[model samples]
Target: MSTVTNQAVGKVTRTRGSRAWRPYLYHIIVGLLSLLMIYPILWMAASSLKPNSEIFTQAYTLIPSKLEWNNYVSGWKGIGGISFATYYKNSFIIVIFATIGSVLSSALVAYGFARIKFFGSAFWFGCVMMTLMLPHDVTIIPQYIMFAKLQWLSSFKPLIVPFFFGVPFFIFLIMQFIRTIPHELDEAAKMDGCSKYGIFFRIILPLIVPALVTATIFSFYWRWEDFFNAVLYLNKAQMYPVSLALKMFLDGESISNWGGMFAMATLSLVPVILVFLIFQKYIVEGISTSGLKG
Candidate 1:
């Protein structure tokens, strides 16, 4: 019996040792793939530290012989002497309001869909979901014409006003999460003489924090990266956000500053990266919980 057990233990040990290398190999492959995907961003950042003349010449090189720290200075000053600070300010203002509007409005709409009993609620919720499958390009021309008629052209109104209406994905994400929350809480609030508004403010809202943070992150990221709408509506350089302002670096001619553009581009990603790092846990929780309901 002892000899048989020893043989069995040796076989199990051999199997474990063989499988141990599989996880390491998997990690190695994943690491390589991740590096491959992010290599371009790394190269662009490295090139930002090089002189403008050396950008294309040293494109393949990951390191630079000379660190041209002045790229950041030149980029910040920008064209027309307005400075990138103005653009950064513009972006922050738009993102802050739009994010707030989107998350708040989405919560209200999602609450109605998830909890409130009303006539035609199903139809309205269906209509809202329909918009999810609708391509944004399909409505852009009509929206442009409408906004043009409203005299919202060349202003931030076109960008910020739309967010006051709930975003479809945000509504869906939040509604799903709200459904997972026990309805008993709302009833308990009502038993305590809580009104509908009271229940929302005192009970439901507190429970849906993860979903709200998720919506906020998505809203801020989309608004921060919104170059097309910004360019289309904002003709004046003074009103340009960071996304549009980045375009000023490239003139499609001999005058474009490649080094400065790369430097500014790298800087522009800082806020988004920080936000993600801060709220990554909430974002994951929101997504996971929202999925669990349906």
Candidate 2:
């Protein structure tokens, strides 16, 4: 009996030992995968500090033999007479206005859909959902013609104005989030003489802050990186965003400023990284909770 008990205890110890090593193996695999994914970004940042001559020669190296801080200085000076500061300003303006417009309009529309039932509400919501299937390429030509007729080309109006009408994705995200909230709160607020607008502003808005933040992050990232629209509409060098200006670093007639471009490219990533790091928690919470209705 003692021999059998000892054998059982040995078997349990072996199982426990195996389980303890599994997490370390999983962690190592994950760490290697993460490093692989981030390798290009790490390389870009490292290359930005290297001299133009050594950038290609030592392509695989993550450490610079000599730091070329002048790459940042020259990149900031920009192509032609315009500074990168102007490009940054232009990008920020478009992103900020677009983010604000999309977030507020989407939330309001979502509130209406989630709480207030009206005639043709289902049909209209279905139409909004259908818009998600329509590609931007299909509408660009007509939109361009319309904007041109309004004399809105070569300005930020075309980029900013369209977003004020509520993005379908954000509307859907916030709507799902709003549905998770108890309807009893809306009823209670109504009993206190709160209007539809009041319920939206006072109750719904505050509760869906996570979804709103997630939407805002998405909007900011999209508008900041909008290259195709900016290229189509913006003509002036002064009006170019960072996304468009990055292309200027390559001159067909001249040697491309590889070092400078890499430096600016690294710098451009800062805002996106910062925004994600700060609001990443909201994104996870918003997505996870939005689907689970109370």
Candidate 3:
């Protein structure tokens, strides 16, 4: 009996040792992968502090011999007359309004599809969903022609206006979220002498806050990074956003301000990082919960 007991104790000890090593192994693997993913960003930051010539010389190394703080100052001044602040202001103005327009319009449209029973409602909703599968590039030419006819080209109007109509993907996302919400709430609100608009404002609006935030985050990020539309619609350098201004740093792939570009590029990521950190919880929860319901 003593021999059996010793054998059992030995097996338990072995199992404990194996289990203890698993967590450390997992952590090491994850840490390595995390470093791999962020390595480019780290390199960019280090290079931003490097001298222009040293960027190529020390391309493989993340550390520079001497840190060049002036890269940030020069990058901020940018090329020619306008400054980086002008690009930042333009981006913020477009992003804020576009985010609001997309979230609000998508919510309203989604509510109509989810709650209101109107003629041809199903068909219209189907059309909206179909747009999700449609490629955006297909609409560019037609949209540009229409904007040109309206004399809306070479301005922010082209970028900001379509968001007011509702982004198809966001409309679908919000609609799915609204479907999960119990119709009983709407019914109860109606019984309490609440009109359709009142139900939307008081009940649905508050409940779908997470979904709306998800849409807002996505919309803001996309618009802030949008280069295609900005380049197509905006002709004047003064009206250019950070997306285009960054392009100006390169002169036909020959002479480039490598240090300054890296510096500005790092600065450009700040807003996106801050936003994601702030709303990350809601983003995860919203995307997960607002799906596969009624």
Best by TM-score: 2
Question: Which candidate tops lDDT?
Answer: 2
Candidate 3 or 2, higher TM-score: 2
Off by over 4 Å in 1: 1-10
lDDT tens per residue, model 3, 1-294: 999999999999999999999999999999999999999999988999999999988799988989999999999998897899999999998999999999999999999998899999989988988988899889999999999999998889998988998988888888889999999999999999999999999999999999999999999899999999999999999899888888888888578888898999999999999999999998987888777784
Q: What residue pairs clash in candidate 2, if any at all? A: none
Query: Candidate 1 versus the native: TM-score?
Result: 0.96
In order, candidate lDDTs are: 0.93, 0.95, 0.92
The global Cα lDDT (0 to 1) of model 1 is: 0.93
Which should have the higher lDDT, number 1 or number 2?
2
For model 1 the local lDDT of residue 117 reads 98
Local accuracy of candidate 1 as per-residue lDDT tens digits, 1-294: 999999999999999999999999999999999999999889988988999888988788989989999999999998788999999999999999999999999999999899999999999999999999999889999999999999999999999999999999999999999999999999999999999889888988999999999999999999999998998888999999999999899997667988889999999999999999999999999999999976
Task: Give the CA lDDT, 0 to 100, for residue 178 in model 2.
Answer: 96
lDDT (0-100) at residue 133 of candidate 1? Answer: 93
lDDT of model 2 at residue 182?
A: 91
- Which run of 10 residues does model 3 get worst, by summed lDDT? 285-294
- Model 2: residues >4 Å from true position, as ranges? none
After TM-score superposition, the amount by which residue 283's alpha carbon in candidate 2 deviates from its true location, in angstroms, is 1.0
- RMSD for each of the candidates: 1.6, 1.3, 1.6
